[model samples]
Target: MNLKSFPDEHLQSLTSLEYMWISYCPSMDNSFPCGLWPPNLSNLSIGSLKKPISEWGQQNFPTTLVTLILYGENSGAIPFAKADDTRNTATTSSFLLPPSLTYLYISDFMDMESLSMGLQHLTCLEELVIISCPNLKDLPVTLLPSLSRFWVNYCPKLRKKCSRKGKYWPIISQIPDLDILKAGRT
Candidate 1:
């Protein structure tokens, strides 16, 4: 039985990889390699893994990662703790995220808050979509200047607020160039 996670023996020569779908690897503890990646990797969709993302893992992510889609049952704060095993100490929040990321979609993250705030670092990000996150009450005001498209669906409680102009809107006016769709609107 082949228990190795990476199908290919070496990724050294590979310069670019597109649209990778990785799922259901029981022994795969970490997501990406510790260092080095496809220089042009853009679209990445990963799901169904046990190990959470560590602080060390974040510092070596692909700089070219553009669109990221994460689907899983692990819904909590961003999982990068100091000292790898210790969960108490507060470490510097500088994780190596994709610099060129444009779109991000996170589903079933019921209690996520920091991501909305941390995403301000992705200066090139344009669109963000979140669904089924019942615990998300407020979005950080920092994600406005460059974000153009925003969509939040199936979050019933998020729809009760009114815009600054007194119109019933789910998301607030903070989304500078948003194409917002209310629940009842077609």
Candidate 2:
């Protein structure tokens, strides 16, 4: 069922819920309801959310969450880095990813300019796929030691930086498998 607004008490009542998909719910407006995270939820997919994910703190999610998919259409940028005026690049740090998360897929994040350094904390993350995030320019690959598969599609700037001998190359070179596909190339 699809809803424009999800009541907190109703969500809290679904303790047994393991997976949830919310699409076209603009009323959610970027911030999920506080204290409504289902303890057993393992998979969550949100599409067309306007708010950047930086506002979602660690306490807002369930510890059991294992997979997260975020798809934004014309949504604003994701705050992933803090820029240093002296340097041309931004610093990466761990974001509020759930510890049990093993797979993460982000698509069409129009406002993402850089990856958050907080990504390093996803110790169990095995695969990360980013698609159609055109403005994303950097990745903190060194922090994600457990990542086995990395894929990028439709992100021209990021793909170039991850190229062999590129500035970001050495950091991601150790990953077991890497796929950098051009836009619309599948």
Instruction: Write down the TM-score of every candidate.
Output: 0.64, 0.77
Question: Which lDDT tens digits does candidate 1 get at residues 106-152?
Answer: 66655554454445567787887766655555554555455677777
Error of 2 at 47 (Å): 2.4
- Model 1: colliding residue pairs: none
lDDT against the true structure, per candidate, is 0.54, 0.69
Q: Candidate 2: which pairs clash?
A: 77-111, 92-117, 93-117, 93-118, 94-117, 94-118, 95-118
* Model 2 Cα lDDT, one tens digit per residue, 28-48: 653553435678899998767
The per-candidate count of clashes, in order, stands at 0, 7
Model 2 clash count equals 7
Q: So what's the TM-score on candidate 2?
A: 0.77
Error of 2 at 83 (Å): 19
